[model samples]
Target: MSKNLADLNSLEERISALEKIAENFKKRAAEIDEKGEFVYENIADLKNCGYTVLTIPKVFGGKETSLYDYIRLQEVIAQGDGATALSIGWHMGVVRNMYENKWNPKVLAAVYEDLHAGALINAAATEPQTGSPTRGGKPQTKAEKIGDKWVINGHKSFTTMSVVLDYFVVSASIKDSEEIGNFLIRKEKKGIRIEETWDSIALKGTGSHDVYFENVEVEQEDYVETLGGAKRVNPWLLHIPACYLGIAGAAQKEAVLFAKNYAPNSITGTISELPSVRTKIGELELKMLQAKYFLYSVSKKWDETKEEERELLLPQLSAAKLVVTNTAIEVVDLAMRIVGARSLSAKSPLQRYYRDVRAGLHNPPMDDMTIGQLANFSLNKY
Candidate 1:
């Protein structure tokens, strides 16, 4: 008999209990799809495990879980299947943005209720010209007011989990006003097209395809919020870190495994026995520890602090994403070094992990931009 999670006597206890299964999911994540597919067959079970609802606030049918718990949970999910974790992370993280929005009470309730019911979501704000929405650009997607409705026209690229997302938080420019707004777009809507154009070397299975909207009409009331010329707390963007955290956590775990099993015939022992290998592992371990702690800490802060307090931490959040993703790439490379040519095989996960971890640095506030921001902030101080 399936148990209603709402009926659990102690939700924390149940989540802790569920985390154990999440660990199992992580280990079996890659093993489940040796071919590195991304349709995410396990997404349903992820909800059953209480992951999809974990980020939601209790007031809106969400657990409104602690930030630390959210980060840890993301790590668990990512460890299983990097692509799957990366795919769902954007949607799960966006729930926080959704709660913070001025969406209609009924729409908000409906969204969360389904999240509680084990559904996933995806935010579609990226475009072909602008790239990941985090870079901050005027969208090519235009939404024109047409009588009682809005006609949305444009293509969105890198729409992760577009197939399974209950709805997309699509971004577009308001005609006449030159204002930017985000609206809730449903898959069933007419004139909305799903294009299978996700051709990437990494995260191949994420199905982050190009989406075409041709006069797709939407009600005015469904508009989530107006982005309105660059304000603080960009609601349409709140993932990246969660995705990289999972990959970093996975890399760390892989590093541990390699360190334990890598016996080299040259030393008549495991390469892990060598000081050089251990030194590399040590470098990776330290970086992983730092990134993991930063990711979890920031997530918790996001959950607890008032809106004002969050602004001061944006730079820190950017740093966390940059560091975590970079560390994941570094850590995975170190692990591959321990395994040598063996890790280069198509059969080896090291190759896939390598490509996947680098994706973090490529997405959202690009590493160069983050570095530039850090530099600018430092230069302006004092």
Candidate 2:
């Protein structure tokens, strides 16, 4: 088979397996959200199915899933449970980026081994004071070279998958220097504690708790990479939009199901027959198509572009994120409109989808920044 056809076949097989796992996730998603508990079992299911290691480099004995394929997998998982998909998306995307960027060889080897053994990892960069790392916030998390080991001390906010992650790629300022470096810290390290502070109304099951590192130490080899100023366009970040799109997909499914069955005394048949409801559904489909096309097209471009040339695609990448994330929010809103007031019910999945989809607005490549980049690109090109 051709490479593209082989990849397609592989993706189909993987997605089919994920669909079965996602069905179980869908059953418990509401409860997991209601309790604001981490989707431990859902994550375990992913690990058991070897989905966690699919993005590891092929040299590392992984499937080496393409960026487009990974995003599709994330969307599928999100349709099952947005929280689980969002949480795991971080691990999957980070793994892909880390390998593609070629982090410290020894460190990468070790992490890959752990990944193959079902370990999960995510970057812990957001801090209470510094805010999102995307805004060039120097981490308050400090790492000091204490003899042969580095002692890391600080708190990280929004450490998603905190309850389940075996490794944390923490960004910290190097003590007594202007440099910031990312350190790979194992969860089993001493002086590390999780503060369950993720109380957001969105993606509650994400377990985005605060992690405190009071004198946590790691070997010198764990000091993976120094932070750099240039913002390289990372295609793996597309997983974020894929996740929200998946949540919107779930909302669409629920709205359609409700419309096809919900009959009002004012109507002769189900609400699906109503023109207004049909219009909303049509709008949902339009937005979904727009978002999916934008997301997948950009991802395909990223996969096809050479490493040096990929940097030039930053504007397009950010635009894709901007379009898809905003469209996802709108799609969920339309779905809720189709479902009416019952969509706001605490028991309804639409409510959860609404909250989860809104969280995408807070993800990296914020809409305003994306617009600014597009404007700059146009002005410079002209």
Question: Best-fitting candidate, measured by TM-score?
Answer: 2
TM-score of 1: 0.88
Candidate 2 has what TM-score?
A: 0.96
lDDT of 1 by residue, 218-247 (tens): 887778788865456542233566666666
What lDDT score is found at residue 320 in candidate 2?
A: 85
Indicate the worst ten consecutive residues by lDDT in candidate 1: 1-10
**Best candidate according to lDDT:** 2
Candidate 1 lDDT score at position 240: 63
Cα lDDT tens digits for candidate 2, 1-382: 2222223357887787788889999999999888889999999888877778878888888778888898999999999999899899899888887876669888899889988888999999999898989888899999999999999999999999998889999999998999999999999999989999999999999999999999999999998888887756778888899999999999999999999999989979999998998999888898899999999999898889987788899999899888988888998998988888999999899998998899999999888889999999999998
Residue 254, candidate 2: alpha-carbon lDDT: 94
What are the lDDT scores of the predictions, listed in order?
0.72, 0.89
The clash number for model 2 is 0
Candidate 2 scores a C-alpha RMSD against the true structure in Å of 2.8
